[model samples]
Target: MFRRTFWFTTGVATGVWATTKVNRKLKQLTPENLAVAAANKAIEAGGRLRDRAVDFALEVRDNMARREAELGDALGLNAPVDRALPPPRGYAVIENRNSPKYVEGPGQKSTYTTYPYNRNEDH
Candidate 1:
């Protein structure tokens, strides 16, 4: 009667819903779907790694340039060289390699260590 028809319809709907859910799960488990998912994830990871590597290289280059300039200034390497003569007025090298090497004239009094000490020291 009416109750029987209602139960029959309910059972059919439930069966159809279960079938659709199982078919969707099976599609996800298939080799093609899994491979596509893995490939997408790998591509995403590679892109992230590449970006990080590029950032690190750029940082290293910047710091290296900065350090090179600092060294050039310390060692007097940035100064223009005059190949002709040993001029009376110029930069002088101190005993310490870490110190700044510059002087305007022989008459100037400065903290730089020079010739007097080298003459006094026993070689």
Candidate 2:
């Protein structure tokens, strides 16, 4: 009698646990939950793809620069030439069209002139 009672209790407990587990899974399988899960997975995949692309681009750029340097050395063009940066264009210069410096006389040509300016041409 005791053995039969123990088996009956164990069977009831197992059935209850299985039913709860199945119901929980069914709730998660709803359309709304499924869509959310799919979107989250897609976003994760996109992020990974973007990271890979950026890494690939950086690698390609680094290799290209190195190869160019090698080619420059072979061509005897690797010597460091004069590297000078131009003066910055300030807001004052850009806005001051009436300034004497900006006034384009026959001799003084504006840098933005459509035609080339030659000092020898005036002589």
Candidate 3:
């Protein structure tokens, strides 16, 4: 009797353990879990691609600026290089009151008044 009871209990325990493991594995392999994992990997890849693109763009801009300076020196242009940032249209205080002010009508819920001042042409 003792031997039979022990064997029966061992069998029940083994069956329960196997069932729990199989259920857990099936849940992990479901379509919803797989899709979510794939989406996360895709998002990570996209972010990496964007960062690489931005870095490439910045490097290209720097190289172009350097090449332009070298060409200017070789050509012997005596004009002083100006790197000052121009003030934005709204923030710039126009000295000449007669300077032309171009009005842009409301388009797409945005209304803007722009001053058409040419930097090359001094007022």
Candidate 4:
């Protein structure tokens, strides 16, 4: 009789342990639970991407301002125009036209070519 009771107790404990483990595993594998986890992961990834894009944009703006200042200095302009220029007041005009024709002076060789070159080439 004692042996029967011991076996019964052991079986109940084993069943309870198995049930808890299966429940835990099922919760982990459920589609709704996985979807929520995936959404959280996507949100984290998007936040990182946004931060990188902002950093890249700021870097590009800074470089453009530096280059504009350098060009103004080389041209002997009295005041730096970029620093003084305000943001466009109205809808921005898109000037998509090609560059103006190069005019050569007397006794100057025509070195103009249609191929693109860096802006510093003129300096």
Candidate 5:
């Protein structure tokens, strides 16, 4: 009787332990848990992409501004005209199709205007 009781108790303990482990595994494998994980990952990726795009746009704007300033200096253009007064000492004012163009003179503007170089030139 004693041996039978001990065997029965051992069997019950083993069954309970196995059942608990299976339940935990099932919880982990549920569709809800997997979907939540995928959504979190997608949000993280989208945030990173947005940050990169913003940074790229800012960099492009800065470079364009710098290039514009350099071109103005190279063309010997005076500072952009003030609507209130005539252009400064060396600057000539020009009317632009889309925007008002201010410069030293038409002569300098045409002189410095660059044409596209040979496109197929051998390196």
Candidate 6:
């Protein structure tokens, strides 16, 4: 009787363990798990892109300052003179008469006819 009870308890414990292991494996193969993995990968990629952009901006700033200093030296000016120069300006919009017009062109006439047609009547 003692041996039978022990075997019964052991069998129950083994069955529970097997069931838990199968459930865990199935959960790992679920769509929700896959989506979570994909999202994590995307976030990692985005972080890398953000870091590269910051590095690129810093590089551009360093290069521009170096070039300005070189130009100042070649022009017989001191480094401090380059620092006194104003920051570069953005594009400017010019309003000139020769600019293209959105209106009708020369010698072109626009005619509008009424919805109801009356061939016998003249306007």
lDDT agreement with native, every candidate: 0.83, 0.82, 0.80, 0.80, 0.77, 0.78
Candidate 2 residue lDDT tens string, 1-123:
999999999999999999999999998999999999999999999999999999999999999999999999999899888789988986542435643334466776553433365554323
Candidate 1's displacement at residue 70, Å, is 1.3
Worst 10 residues of 5 by lDDT: 95-104
Which lDDT tens digits does candidate 5 get at residues 20-92?
Answer: 9999989878999889889999999999999999999999999999999899899977577757976668856
- The C-alpha TM-scores of every prediction are 0.53, 0.61, 0.47, 0.48, 0.45, 0.46
Q: Which residue pairs show backbone clashes in model 1?
A: none
Query: Compared with the true structure, what per-residue lDDT tens digits does model 3 show for residues 38-121?
Result: 999999999999999999999999999999988988897746878999887775654443444433345643334564766844
Ranking by TM-score: 2, 1, 4, 3, 6, 5
Query: Candidate 2 lDDT (Cα, whole model)?
Result: 0.82
Enumerate clash totals for all models, in the order shown.
0, 0, 0, 0, 2, 0
- Residue range 2-119, candidate 1, lDDT tens digits: 9999999999999999999999999999999999999999999999999999999999999999999999999999898888977688766436444444344567654554554344
Name the candidate, 1 or 4, with the larger TM-score value: 1
Predicted structure 3: lDDT: 0.80
Candidate 1: where are CA atoms >4 Å away?
A: 1-15, 80-123
Which of 1 and 5 is the better model by lDDT? 1
Off by over 4 Å in 3: 1-21, 78-123
Which ten residues in a row are the worst by lDDT in model 2? 92-101
Model 2 RMSD in angstroms: 15.9
C-alpha lDDT of residue 34 in model 1: 100
- Evaluated at residue 106, the lDDT of candidate 6 is 61
Which scores greater on lDDT, model 2 or model 3?
2
Candidate 6 segments exceeding 4 Å error: 1-14, 77-123
